[model samples]
Target: MRYAYDAQSGQCLKFVYRGYQGNGNGFDSKEECEDQCARSLYDFA
Candidate 1:
C-alpha cells in the first residue's frame, strides 16, 4: 500500500501500488504525506 496527497482535499489517501516505477510524489504513509504536504495547511502564523 501507498499514499498520495490530494491537493483539493488537502489529505493523504491510500491505495495499492500495482507496478514498480519510481517518483518523489508517493508517500509511504498518511503521516509521512501529512508531514511533508499537509503541514503547510495547518501551520499557524
Candidate 2:
C-alpha cells in the first residue's frame, strides 16, 4: 500500500493499494506519508 499528502497543507490526501495507478505521491506506508508531511511542515517552519 501507499499514501499521498498535500505538501502545502501537510495533510494526508489518500492511499494507493497494490495494482493501481497512483498520483505519484504514494508512500510505502501511512506513517511514512505522515512523516513526510511533518518533515515538509518543519522545513517550511
Candidate 3:
C-alpha cells in the first residue's frame, strides 16, 4: 500500500494498493501518483 499527502497541509490525499486482490487505487509510478494528487488539489481549489 502507498499513500500520497498534501505538501502544505500534510493531509492524506490518495491511497494506492498493489496486490492480487485489487481493492484500492493504483498508480503506475510515484510520478503518476503525485500528478493525480496535484490534479485533485486543483480540482477542489
Candidate 4:
C-alpha cells in the first residue's frame, strides 16, 4: 500500500513526500537512507 500507520495516527509512513517515492520515501543511496531515516517515520508495517 502507499501508506500505513501504527495503532495511533501519531505515527505514519507515506510512499511519496517532497518529490521522493517508493513503498515509502526512498533515498538516492544507502547513506541518504540512513540520514533520512533519522528524520522520517517508519514504525508502520
Tens digits of per-residue lDDT for model 2, 14-42: 55477666565778777888887788778
**Candidate 1: regions farther than 4 A off:** 39-45
Tens digits of per-residue lDDT for model 4, 1-45: 233433254433444345444354444544455455544555533
Highest lDDT against the true fold, candidate: 1
> How should the candidates be ordered by lDDT, best one leading?
1, 2, 3, 4
In model 3, which regions exceed 4 Å deviation? 1-24
lDDT of 1 by residue, 1-45 (tens): 988888787678987877688566588888898797766666753
Worst 10 residues of 2 by lDDT: 15-24
After superposing candidate 4 on the true structure, give the runs of residues whose Cα lies further than 4 Å from its correct spot.
1-24, 41-45
What are the TM-scores, per candidate, against the unseen true structure?
Answer: 0.66, 0.56, 0.46, 0.30
TM-score, structure 1 vs. true: 0.66
Backbone clashes for every candidate come to 0, 1, 0, 0
Q: Evaluated with TM-score, which candidate comes out highest?
A: 1
Q: List the residue pairs that clash in candidate 3.
A: none
| Model 3 CA lDDT for position 29 | 58
